[model samples]
Target: MAKSKLSEKEQVTEYIQKLDPSLAETITFLRQAILAIDGEISEHIKWNSPSFYYSGDMKPFNPKEYKRDILVMNLHRGTTILLVFPTGAKITDTSGLLEGNYPDGRKIAKIKDLDEAKSRQKDLENAIRNWMGQIEK
Candidate 1:
């Protein structure tokens, strides 16, 4: 039998399953929090990590714009889970969830552990929703 390719979400699940239990819990919680914001947002493996993107119909634009990308989980630093928000410069964040400035229009939100993750859950979701609200439908 041919080897089957895992679905995007299944791949994400597998990725989370391989993490340290604490990190896994945090990632899973944040993933749920993000997905709960909008039904159009979907997940996949991108940039060597589990990434989320908008799957809804939108006005066509240049692929270089990366308008469909929502966020990608960057776990290179171990305990610190970094959510990379592409085009995050567009969001008017007041919740203090976003940090750092990159000329490429990328911003990052960092979560350390489950306690911090739970506390910042609302802020994180708000920031993501802020990103989603600007999407061209």
Candidate 2:
């Protein structure tokens, strides 16, 4: 059963906090990244996970329903995809991407270095834009 009084995004954030303190920074960065991509993007919790959705869309693409929207960008996005940082997970193959160990094996194309992160920002923005374009058609 879902916990009462907590929104989906809050639940996801609380889950991440339980996973590791280090992840707090990462989660914050991710939230900011999502906001940067689309100023109008809306955030919410879905299936106990934090989800960023396009504003005005009634559909809440939870982790389970992400496949329906190819542009949602998450772990389900094939090999090269965004890695969702679930509590207590670890990322093993973080070679050449970042300088630290990600507790979760989740692999997100999002990186940390200022320059690389900036590039990733562009990639993410473009992906969202493409998805929005399709939705508008």
Model 1: per-residue lDDT, tens digit, 1-137? 99899999999999999988889999899889888888988999899898999999999999889999999989998689899998999988998788989999999999999899999988888888888889898
Clashing pairs in 1: none
lDDT over C-alpha atoms for residue 91 of model 2: 23
Q: Score candidate 2 by TM-score against the native.
A: 0.49
lDDT scores of the candidates, listed in order: 0.90, 0.47
- Please provide, for model 2 over 1-137, each residue's C-alpha lDDT reduced to its tens digit, 9 standing for 90 to 100: 88589765666667657644444455556567777766657676554445666565544445553422222224232223343423112223223332224643232454433345445665555545555554432
TM-score of each: 0.95, 0.49
- In model 2, what lDDT does residue 74 have? 43
**Which candidate number has the best lDDT?**
1
- Residue 48, model 1: Cα distance from true site in angstroms: 0.9
How many steric overlaps are in each model, in order? 0, 10
